[model samples]
Target: MSAPSSVPLVVHVIDQLGIGGLEVVLVNLINNTPTDRYRHAIICLRGATDFKNRITVPGVSIHTLGRRPGKDFSVFRRMWSVLRKLRPAIVHSHNLPTIDMCVPAKLAGVRRLVHSEHGWDISEERGSSRKYNMMRKVLSPLVDRYVPVSKDIETWLRTGVGLPASKVLHIYNGVDTDFFHPAEGNLIPLPAPGFDLANRVVFGTVGRMQTVKDQVNLAKAFVELSRLRPDLMERARLAMIGDGDLKAECESVIAAAGLTDKTWLPGARNDVAELLRGLNVYVLPSISEGISISILEAMSCGLPVAATRVGGNPELVLEGETGLLMPSRDPVALAEALATYMDQPELMQKHGAAGRQRIEQSFSVTSMVNGYLGQYDQLLGRQHP
Candidate 1:
């Protein structure tokens, strides 16, 4: 391990460190990274929650902008103040809302600025809209390096946003295999009520209950599956994790479908690895994704995945090998895929084993941390030399 003197002060800027894929990645980076090689800090534009407690590293500072609901100019002023005081070597911003931090970071004399594109939000997914593309173009110069979590994102930056391919680097999100591995023995603990593991084949998914994630579609698919195969009603159950604007809407759908007993909406969960192990199969019915960390965690837990074919999901799940990949927003396809696993027990075991092997070989947390460290070293070397 390199000494603290050799390490640079790296600060991460995010919109809100809430319960989501990006937040999980940020937490993992702070927790798993060696302090000897990287002194880290986090800045949340709209304040942070108990999620900050997840970072176990000592001496890591966290600053929240405390911006209100509307547009706040004070965010920029606060960012500048923090940057000036900390004098970080790199200001790494994630997603679009936080991307604006690069401007203040640049103004504050931060030497290197890195912007990571996790995925497109609902508004950006409505076919490239000229206004958003223009904004990206205007802000493109502020970032020194673009870190896109998927190849699709890199392609978008190059073709859609007209960013240089040379500056864009593709880095897939990783999962902690040790922390999220398959549960020993057979008994797994349930984190919420209404989920009885003794008599049901638990089908679970972890994601924000938002429009982009499309939890409504997952509910529709589950209800359709129950209608088609009444036998599964006796053995199958749905566990929808995470909470968002659409939770009440999703609950209403479940009630209408008469799946109140078969489905459980436990909101956002902190013990993801344990929750993943409690399930027999893992599913991600997202309309869009950028290498979902939940999918990786599930795969690492030795659970077969059934994910929508969008964004970086295809790269993580190898279709029939690791898990099945169905078209996005298609309830029939999603239900059919889920039904296949329900009918075939051996297939689930085979696919789940393959998924675990894939994660161990390619997507380990160590590899991800080292990849970011390599990028930091390369950028710093170029600056100093």
Candidate 2:
């Protein structure tokens, strides 16, 4: 497709290019947006990572501020200069760390400002903290529109931060159903050797190996299930795809339970959609989420999910239909849910098919892209109408 004659450039400002849900969405937006109507750019507050390789668009430019560890005012100063130079029509910032970008974007005379809250940080200011809520309250006016990816985040912005409910726009994260869809006629390959996919029931999950994702609990749950039904050790396997600080801890738990052979920890992977198609069942054991894109990817690949009942998971998983919901940090409950899927293959297939249907209907990449484009048009009309 050729570029538009007068495209509006939208610059996405992110803290870092880490492998996470927010980063994945930003990449998708850039790659999938119509070149005819929108020109996109990315500005990373911290220096960019290999994640930059994922953007395939030819003209999309990526800039970084190269800020150090501590709080630095100079980073914002540099960001202001970049905004002035680029002169983008929209400056869109993601999550908390880069929320400060709005200050610079505003000062640099950018007319439209957007901020998206992906998920809460796990530090002392974890989602429930009053101090963080107050900070959001103060920053609300700086953002022309507050885009929260889930209903839970909208509630937090309204009640927790005291932001006007009207100012919050709920936009669920979209998955590339075309990219993540189940392959036809053996098109997608299986997992690597020793990670057998022949007769075993594979339970897979993909996310950062971080505290809120709770990979440790997922490992313990797999162990407990094995203890309860030793035969499942031969019939069921776990596939965790991603690397983080908790990898060693999750590995130690599997080793202690003699599940080193059954569990496959294949660090960061690029072929996530293909990986989702190989699984019999998918799980997201996150303590918090803002409409998990991985969950949507699994659904698009026709896999039944078993995720924690937190954040926007419930909005995606239809309990008994798309997948089961278990409480966070409860290994026994997770195991029991897994056992149900293992024991009843028909139910698993039924739910998996339902999930795939849901994605085709509601969560397709086209729908997600259109939603954002519609929002942008609406914002533009408001400005120029």
- RMSD of every candidate to native, in Å, equals 2.2, 2.2
Off by over 4 Å in 1: 1-6, 187-199, 382-385
Query: All candidates' TM-scores?
Result: 0.94, 0.95
Error of 2 at 266 (Å): 1.4
lDDT of 2 by residue, 253-353 (tens): 99998889888898999888878877889989888888898999899988899999988999999999999999988999999999999999999889989
- What does the lDDT read for residue 11 in candidate 1? 95
Question: What 10-residue stretch in candidate 2 is worst by lDDT?
Answer: 185-194
lDDT to native, each model = 0.86, 0.85
Best by lDDT: 1
Model 2, position 126: C-alpha lDDT score? 33
- Model 2 RMSD in angstroms: 2.2
